[model samples]
Target: MQNYKKDFPIFKNNPSLIFLDSTSSTQKPEYVIEWICDYLSQSYSNIHRGLYDIAINSEKMYFDSKQKVADFLGTHDLKEIIYTYNSNYALNIISQTLRLNKVLKTGDKVLVSIVEHHSNIVPWLILKEEIGIELEFVRVTQDFDIDFDDFEKKYDEKVKVIAFTHVSNVTGKIFDVERIGKLKRPDTLFIIDASQSFPHMKLDVPKMNCDFLFFTAHKVMADSWLGVIWGKRELLEKYKPIFSGWWAINEVKKECFKPGALPFKFEPGTPNISGALSLLKALEYIEKIGWYETVESIEKELIEYSLEQFRSRPYLQLIGNTESKKRVWVFWFYIQGVHALDIADAMAENNICIRAGHHCTEPFMNYLKLSSSARMSLYIYNSKDDIDAFFKILDTNFNPTWLTK
Candidate 1:
């Protein structure tokens, strides 16, 4: 674990500062940063628009990034991986495109779980109201896991899409997407918000049996403001883009403005060529360092250890501890006598940064009857010492009001 910490620059540089907010965004490693710098400084050029050699190289790099993302997600069809600004944009694209194509219709229903982040929830809600599509949330079990039995019970022919999170950002509860997809009627499409899982666990969209999946590079220790969306090629072909940009047709000026085929149709702007290459480097770093080894090691040292540290605390309320095999090492908890914001601030003062809020899933918080919670999320770069430091600070129960002095 000490050797693993060297790969992430932030930990090596700021070893004293315990960072537990990986659910929000992870710190980029030196390699990811250097990769972006090298691309922008040495090979900087507009892709597909410039006639220079740099432009040709840039275009290839951008396209290769797409291929890398496809291979990372276990898909061979490079055209299925669409570049977007972020995971939120990717989800919106999926929702808007499906709604526009009438795949989501007036009488049709879309099923989502109660544990979804706002990113997963809001787009569908907007479409449900706009198209008069019925939107429903499947109930979660007491441990905050997807209620598979209830999901099966609620599922029916009227449901056209089942969009849910692969892992809950707040609860760290992992959804068995393969099992969830199997419960859906054959006609229904399965969409997975893989933001939480992609960074922490081994995932393949095909193995998960999802029709669509979204994840951001920043969350996965890659470049900022870049994300990947994977969908079935046929669905990408059939779906219309609601948020079209001029760059969508950069390659097809000779084609009289026909939408660029497959991925480009979804990626409608000057793509983040540098960011994409940086993401590739980050992906390579993850692979070379051994993703499964890192994931399991982090789970053992940070996630499981953190959960154990909090288990006996009487004032804390921990969510998402299930016997199911699907859970990743993420966990959310709230202090009994302390406000989540206050607790987070207290931790922050001690150089322990964790996240405290509704986590953009206001509806889920509302369902859980909590406006917010103090979330301690873990990733490969995190260690058991970070968890110990967090718990040590949390044990102090310092009131935020005292900081005013």
Candidate 2:
């Protein structure tokens, strides 16, 4: 529909290739790529490290990028955002210190969802092992959305923290964060991993009411992700930096001690300046294209058509949300007698790129009795022709007998 493929250099570089793995990482737009190259070539310097104009200019651009990203998310408080290497790093920073706070003591409970990515689940598991905190998971329904009843059963005063994905990577089902956030106990903290949702929708922290949220840049069409972590300003101000570094210094006097302010307290080293700046450019591209509604409209139609086709194919088992309204363009499915890995290899020969794996959500896969499935994730650039080409290859030459035999 929108057809922005011309804006990405990758398609031009490989004209015959069809890429449908936007959930893992999006192809970069020309503007974002150019911005990164320009900064590296013309103005590369360590930020906040020198008095010279070159360094000052670098620092200005770096901080301004932060402000732009903050404004993009409908906040003016630059203090709320911290830059890190990726979503895993950002969430790890939170997991490292959040439990040590008075609120989440040993034996306190935490809740997660069955659809959570490994990055969201592993940190809590580590906290459980290291500190004796208890962990629980909300179930996924037969239709593939979060089971709110199960969520309510798992949530209570004993649960000191709750974390989940706003949009699942494998299913692309958008969760009602507002509904879940409201269910949180009075003192219980809520965290959201918006890695998939951030690329497809608009998010404002005040609206979400989450204590902390994180998303990776690469998934949003910015190459070489560093992540963005947003927290409630007051909460961040009181939280201690989990790691120590020279940049986290707040006082230098003898016998004087205090951690740095909001973002600086959390971001404790030389930052991902270029990646952050490129993410800002990616945001600009999204804004220029239009709001999430139009993007969602295109995706909903694509997903409807896709689900209809998958349902008609006797040999295929479609997974994820059954209704279009509950899902975005992401889909997962496995064909009978076809190994997911073998399917992916055959698709590669047909000049198509798709992902096949448990996708790091192995527990969820286990629940479905699926060892692996092929994933197709879409973007605004994808069109009906792309789907036709994808399905055509699958129907005709998916797994040659030589490989299958």
Candidate 3:
């Protein structure tokens, strides 16, 4: 498999750094970095609320980027796209908007999967606390797959929303979202958290038939603190403005607020113009690199090879689905008698980066009866050598499993 290692500039600058924590955030490619620098240097101004050349150019760039995002995602509607600080912020806005607008009422139940990231869980928990909405969880099976039976059992007439992750960041198991979407009741709104899957797979909004989807740009090979909320236009229109400031103007007299159009109503305040442009570049970069199929094939080979080597390690214990077909390139496990942090520190000492601890999915960890674990997540840039280096770092009595060439 061809490894496009040179596409990322960080490798040229810091040649020894092996980035295995792509699940957390990926290294920016040369294209994205250059686009950011060029955009900031040439045109740096606030978007909209102004008519000067700089402002007009910035707003055009910003809106054009939104259109590009919608096009990239294969969505039919551009008006449904709303950008936020990150995925957590998007989910919080959806939950809050639903509540503040009284679309989701007290005593309504929302079903969430146990495998969700904390971003998916905490917002609903807050809703339950602040608005008296009941929270329900779909269970995870022994292999870390979402229990469809439990998910079905939790559904009822009172369940207004079904929130879930399309893929587990810790386990790398892809949820059967289309099948789950079929279980929605007449009034049930399906909210998908695609923070993990969006980067690695192809998604079609109408095909998925979800009311709302949440994903962050960082995890998809872009910069930080940028998120996307893809809501059905009708659902977005139902959103009540939480921050009533300069943008949320309805009445001229006392400034009693009515919501603005599709996106701006929810995304009030000054926008992250650079973040949006960079994300657009990231999408272009991914497309330029052959998108999901090419990346998926390469990473699958890397993980399969890595899993074989992992099976030989006596101290290392593999978590979730051991077979490569059931998961992505992410592997999480605990070594006997070695703290996850210690392993992480050792890896860091060897100039490799990996994630350790609950991974912001403590509920899933709790479900598995684990305090913590370490993760080595791969991406398009990762190679078999990176996995070999990680394994070599893990063992004190290192044996060469790699080709000298």
**For this target, which candidate reaches the highest lDDT against the unseen true structure?**
3
**lDDT of every model, 2 decimals:** 0.79, 0.82, 0.84
Tens-digit per-residue lDDT, 1-405, candidate 1: 543567777877876777778789988888888777877788899886888999998888888878888887888788998888898888888888887787888988889998888888788889877888888899998877778788877788888999998888877777778888666667999999999888877777777778999899998788788978899998888776776666665344554566667777877668787778888888888888876666666576555566667775655677777332457766787866677899888888888888888888888888878877888877777777777787777766642343245
* lDDT against true structure, model 2: 0.82
TM-score of each: 0.92, 0.94, 0.94
RMSD for all candidates, in order, please.
3.3, 2.5, 3.0
The TM-score, computed over Cα atoms with residue i paired to residue i, of candidate 3 is 0.94
Between candidates 2 and 3, the lDDT winner: 3
lDDT, residue 3, candidate 1 = 33
Off by over 4 Å in 3: 248-252, 397-405
RMSD of 3: 3.0
Q: Tens-digit lDDT track for model 2 on 1-405?
A: 567889899899999879998998899999999988998999888876798887998888778778877886777778888888889987888887787665567999889898888998888889889888898988988877789988888887789888989999998889999888777666888999989988887787677778988889898888675988888888887877777566777776676666776667777778878887898788888878776776777877788888777676666677877678867788888887788998788888888889999997987888888887999878877888888888777777543443376
Q: Which digits, one per residue and each the tens of the lDDT, describe model 3 over residues 1-405?
A: 888889999999999989999999888999999988987898789976788898898888788778877876678577888889899999998898888878789999999998889999999999888989999988988887878888878898889999998988988998888887777766889999999888888887777779999899998777888899988887677666666545545444564556566657667778788898888888888788888788888878988898898898756798877888767889988976667998899889989999999999998788788987999999888888888899888776322233222
Question: For each predicted model, how many residue pairs clash, with residues at least 3 apart or on different chains?
Answer: 0, 0, 0
- What is the clash tally of candidate 3? 0
